[model samples]
Target chain A: MRWVDLVKVEARIAPLKAARPGDGRGSQSARVSVTETGGQLSRSSTGGVARLVAGGVWTIATADRLEPSIDEAVNTLRGTVEIDLGSIVQIDTAGAWLITRLERELSARGVSVSLVSASENARRLLEALAPAERDVPPPPETIGVVQELLEAVGRTMVRSWEDLKSGLGILGGVVRGLSIGLRHPRRMRFTSIIFHMEQTGLRAVPIIALMSFLIGAIIAQQSAYQLAYFGADIFVVDLVGILVLRELGVLLTAIMVAGRSGSAFTAEIGSMKMREEIDALSVIGLDPLHVLILPRLIALILVLPLLTFIADVCALAGGGMMSWAYLGLPPDTFITRLRDAVALNTLFVGLIKAPFMALIIGIVAAAEGLRVAGSAESLGTHTTSSVVKSIFMVIVVDGIFAMYFAAVRY
Target chain B: MRGAGKNPEEVIRGRGITVGFGDRLILDNLDIDVYRGEILGVVGASGTGKSVLLRTILGLQPMRAGEVEVLGVPYSDAAPAARSAVDRRLGVLFQHGALFSSLTVLQNVQVPMREHLRLSPRLMDELARLKIELVGLAPDAADKMPSELSGGMIKRAGLARALALDPDIVFLDEPTSGLDPIGAADFDALIETLRDTLGLTVFMVTHDLDSLYTACDRIAVLGDRRVLIEGTMGDMMAFNHPWVQQYFRGTRARRLGA
Candidate 1:
């Protein structure tokens, strides 16, 4: 046997050795040689029949030593070969596979092979191997990188188009739901809308207040340091007032709500979709769009503008406090300068975008949640993508609003 | 058949094994033995520490008292080399298959072989294929992920992994739980065949009455924090425990008898 084959045989024997209860069988196994020193293979011609004899133990422990000889012996045979296993004492899966493989090789060469005097265990194992050996799979084909890249691009385009079509469908559902609610206001699930308002809007007060406050203070402090060189510290109040009222307050607050409420919406609805609770709702004749999505959308639209107003006041107060602390400007004069530098149009500009931003976040999150599949992994993926896509679109809409308000001179 | 008392070498022996979670004692000074080359079916009602017994014997649960011996070697707190030697000879199939969802069937079968053997890649492929075929899975199913398979195929794939190293004793936790009647019967047949061909000592924890009736060589009933009785199906049929009477001759058991 080859040196590597010897090492492999010894490795398999180690587990069998440790598995046996006592050490007495260890010595018995050591004396059982796996090589051709005791094993024998004989071929004889009798009455125009080719008979091949297999003798001694045929097991995994002896497989490596016997494999090459078995392969060589089977190749030298012709049609109508009889494999006589009357003298073979033991056989394992590896030994059985080799015998079956030799039979397969013979069949490919148009030499019919037959077995005689085989053990029952060998016959049963060989029967199990027959179907697998017959139905061999072809090797996989290697593709060029350009082909793979083109395939991926095609798949992505198809997915994006499907997403767009589904978005339009959701929009139609929302419009239809609103029209139905208008026709019968009392049947419009007012309680659910109120409940969601408290969850998404009223519950978000502290976080939105604190985040907008810190942002307002940071802007005032930085702009004050720069304006101090120009000896125009009082203008910090006007700068803070215009920036927070028109852009920063609503933009930052919408982003916060998208992360907080959008993710919550996706997780809650995605888990429902996963459990088929949405299916149950629809089966009971309650439109999922009306029962699940509509209330959430209306709640967000109402709550976001209210939240923007809170953020606006808290930010102005923070700016006034920072101006008082660092620039030594009193609150009375800060409001006085603020009134001169800004107008109601600036404040209304930020409030105007809040509802639309809320709509985008609410719709995107709800849509992503409904897209969840059967598995837990899919639910997680959709939830993460919902938060990411909502945040991205919120910023994108904010940028578009900035340009639109600039163009129309709002 | 070997008698109970005469040089009966138990491949697994548990003595006075007491395991408790908090104040609730699960197994109280339980003693059990699994003889070599026999399929011992452990049965019990739900929440009756049947799985706890299997886990404790496998050294997964820490016992407050008593010692456990597997393959004639004490496993708990033993020398690392001695414990590892015993581990190489034992295989466990947990409930639900617990297959790695990310790995394909072929890769899952290869994991144990890769850790245990130094065979060539070609030999490993051949061996894993044989194992897959042995477990009655189609050859093409080897490349499929666990999520892609049906419940029955998952259990078969798990059985293939358990047989990867040709372990001396295989522990199966509720192996037939999620399968339909036909599927569970086929699985029981597969277990019986494996034991016959491979000389395996199987310790199966099951609630399937059909398995206890047809597949097992002997049955052990666990209740009241210990093994209540262990013997042949005839012995179980004649045993006098009230829980055993209710369990072995219940409406479901009578229907299974039909």
Candidate 2:
């Protein structure tokens, strides 16, 4: 063999050597030999074939030369040893037909022939070497109970504290990134802030307005039924105003933006991370945290307040319309009551929460995006996580505000 | 394809470059040089510090024990502004296209110019379109998202983006590994044309032998923790290095040569 060929063979057979039995069964193992001769085999070459049988099983490596003698040998021995025809470097179709015939003859007598593992041309020739009714051993069946059990436990473990740890790591990255932005306000341009607000906040107006209007109308209509029973339907005006301003207005708007732009932030940045465009920015001596994260955070911060304020206006308008229809209360009276019932603190609480919620959404989304490591699936998962986490954080923050406000009121 | 012979002044000179991930050294005392206006192809077995070298040169990776000079500026000598100034002279095409999905192909190509050059939007668009055309993409492709393109098309689009600023140097990591023979040959021809026309220096990391022979002015065979041999393909074949011989005489190499 050539030196390169010897290296290739040794590299391939290294694992097989480790599997060998150490009790000297190595002597019984099959051996491969290649010999060249000018003589064609009919009967005189039987001794040459004998010289090749140096071990338990012998394989003759030849190229279009020893077909006749090899054919005769196949006919002579049916079950004593495995015959490997797969390694033939070359063959004619007629030779392949003869090999197939020998394969069928031997298989009928309960012997197996070594096939495949040859060069493409030889493998094509050996394709029909298997008999039509030959019985091949079935593949070992897999015990899926262990796999299923392991998968179940694996999934359970993945969803537990480890997942939370990753989530917190992402959260920490967001906070760290945002803190840097705050320290270097120049990192976030005022123009990009305006642009982002126009895109994410101003563009989101119609949806938020429509949603708040429907919610207010629904609340007014529901309260009208209960108030009418007590001959006090006018109270629906007070109910709708207080409920929307105190809770639904800020909460629902944040949730909507969380689902909408928050997830967008996550997906946009996540895809950027996946594609290494973020790395490209760093390589170009631009801080990706500043260029990407800052503008987004600023935009979200500026937009959330305006969106919340619009949602508040629309909800009150819808409630005013419904109150006029059912409660016979004048628009001016309802407006006055809304102005009085929603204390300055309540309005301040909502407005104050807006920037914090924006920061939360922006950080959560960008953090999730940054955490994306692999395929598109990770992006989807992170987007979902960003929305869920931002909304949850928003609600929790709002709840804290509510408690503080209640304590001050009482 | 050989440039007017000069002293081969090094455009990038890396000395004893060492990179580590935690405790494991990915690259150990690796020294390399990329010459001006030369196409250097780096080949190695998998995970043999090929990409680490590329990153270290770009300053994206911090070398634990080494110094590197790119275009006469030490990689870490500059702060942000100076670093960006040095960076403006270079471009990178990663394995994936890494295009900004929200931006159009034209916009993706225009990013470097937008950041560094004070060019007009109309002018940037014109230049970006020119680059896109130069990379053999259709004019209509200039507006499409990255998702709309095929794998080979994405690589070409990435090439267009890398050429956006008309940088003097370019780095392509595995530019043709996934392409069919015809596609790969087309890519090689494109690189050759760019090298001749633009006088750009290229550092290409690849195992594709056809690319090494057809495009690289010199090949750097990376092994044994550093470059084992750096020479022309003919020189590489003549050399008695076992890895080089094995690589040049491989079955796939023979088929590629044929």
Clash totals in order: 0, 0
Question: Who wins the lDDT comparison?
Answer: 1
- Name the lDDT of candidate 2: 0.70
- How far does residue B210 in candidate 1 sit from its true spot (Å)? 1.1
Q: For candidate 1, report its TM-score.
A: 0.78
DockQ of candidate 2 (2 decimals):
0.02
Question: Which one wins on DockQ?
Answer: 1
Best by TM-score: 1
Compared with the true structure, what per-residue lDDT tens digits does model 2 show for residues A111-170? 664442444534443452322223222424767998989988999788656556755665
- Candidate 1, residues A112-186, lDDT tens digits: the string is 888898867567666656665453466479899999999999998997787667667777898899998999898
Cα RMSDs, all models: 6.2, 22.3
**Given candidate 2, what's the lDDT at residue A79?**
41
